[model samples]
Target: MAAAVLAGAAGSAYVVTVVDRPKPVVVSHVAEVLDGETIEVRDGDRVTRFKLVNVDAPAASECLHQESAVKLAELLPEGTPITVVRDGPFVAVSTQDGTLVNAALIAAGLAVPSVNGTMFLDRAKEAHHSAAEQRKGLHSPDIPCTLPGQVRAITEAAAAVEAQPLKGTKTELTVAADTAKTAIGLVDQLAKPGGLTWDAVAPVDQTVLLAKVTKVVPTLYRKEAELRNVVKGLR
Candidate 1:
């Protein structure tokens, strides 16, 4: 649990707040997909940010960024109104099979955990750690960016951090910091624009973190055109 918390603090894990909205259909509208795991849901013209659970997709410049998005569309189509529910502070939706596939994305190397699990959401962090250890690939902020093939990204990242001096070499620290930041950013990018598989958010064990997605407007979500231009700068 301590390791998991540290991992989360260093951007290795995502923290999600459960939304206790008891009344169903409290918010309504169409949602737009931003990347693999993030989506913007329109509720009477209000844009709400939703983080997809389980899965993690690459960022705009990451090797699989667009590919993940395309695959997500293939798996989940736009205009598909899924059951949307409030899971803590986040808005959650259920997958077609309703197995909390959002977290599965991280397991599948498609996305990373977005936030650390709070007291109300610690289970999420534990689940993520278990999943990360299981995959052995897909490095998180706990480690540097690595492939699922490596199967040692976490240990390797941990080693890297251990060897670096916290107050010594600025150059070394910069390198270490960038590597970690990249890993964390990758995770966040995937979490957003993430939603239920445009299917349903239902009672998946009645857990607060695992809310079902009811319905949503389907549309491919790219960043605002203006922000997209900023991405070009990164390239």
Candidate 2:
């Protein structure tokens, strides 16, 4: 019975030792950048691909895709040493200077927060929120290719159209009717799914919509002026 107890105690000690062992530090150098959120790293003779946890960048066909990739390249230059930690299916990468690359991308607005099993996810989400609020990178209104920028342009055009003064003369009424008809058509187009009012309008389509609004606003103003003139004549 004493031998059995000793054997059990020894087995428990062995299990505790194994469980308490620290994980090895993984050190690798950047070999190639796949995109804003993925990179290939070289560790001696082995090269492995790693996706940045808690961040998702624009795809190749999306707006700001190239810019996002360029920013990532700047952050992690070729041969730059990086520390990597596995977080579920993804990995968290940090620079030699201790800058978290995943959070950096989000803070720059080049990437959005992604659902990941990592302790850094909340920090990354905070960075993303700040970037969006500041209108940095892909969220900037100065960038005509971005969705927010396009939406601003469309909203401005609509405001211009609505700013025209209403007139009450007969000739002006006729012109106003024509202008109103055109404006109504434009509004109908904008009311459709994926249109200017939608959250997913394409930049090209937004440009076309802006042009239509710009072209009609002048006519609307002219019609309103003519209608006022007719009213004056009658008075």
Candidate 3:
């Protein structure tokens, strides 16, 4: 009975030592804004580049890249004091006012949540979902360069093509085929990797956009196919 009590006491002590220890953190000041999801912080004479965990912003040449970088600059301008907790290769940065910079980017819709095995991943995901729903920043439908706006454009184009009658005279059939071809080209452009119109759209919006395109594109294919066959017969 004494041995059992001693064993239990040892286990409790081990738990307290391991789980209750404070994590190491870096105290620093922002030296420069690298991009939306990266920053350089100076700790005395040491300067370190910190990439925010669990968020991915648009790359250079992508839609909203400038806007995202501007937002991060606004949040953490040069010389802003910050606290950083290292999580593997990335860090969770917080302003003195208690704002989590990583989650802030996601909430503002400038960045999407990415898995990095960080402790704050769930918070980042929640912020991302809210931003997408609110249509903030990159998710805004008002911006012509954004993914949502492009999807809307494609949807409208497809609708216009579908409205035209598939059965018509040779001239009308030829025009219909031409219109459908244009709409299909837009879809293909959006889906293609490394294309001019391609952007790293958020996964949530991507799922919704995929469903919409899947429903609309097949009808367009049928219309174009029928029109081409009729036009060929007329020729």
Each candidate structure's TM-score, on Cα atoms with residue i matched to residue i, is 0.39, 0.61, 0.68
Question: Per-residue lDDT for 60-112 in model 1, tens only?
Answer: 75544665676555444565444455445554453433323354444444555
Clash counts for the predictions, in order:
61, 0, 0
What's the true lDDT of residue 210 in model 2?
A: 59
lDDT by residue (118-156, candidate 3, tens digit) is 566766777776776788877786777676676676677
* Local error of candidate 3 at residue 26 (angstroms): 5.1
Model 3 residue 30 CA deviation (Å) reads 0.9
The order by descending lDDT is 3, 2, 1
| Selected candidate, larger lDDT, 1 vs 2 | 2
lDDT of 1 at 107: 40
Cα displacement (angstroms), candidate 2, residue 175, comes to: 18
The Cα local distance difference test for each model comes to 0.42, 0.62, 0.71
* Best-to-worst TM-score order: 3, 2, 1
| Candidate with the larger lDDT of 1 and 3 | 3
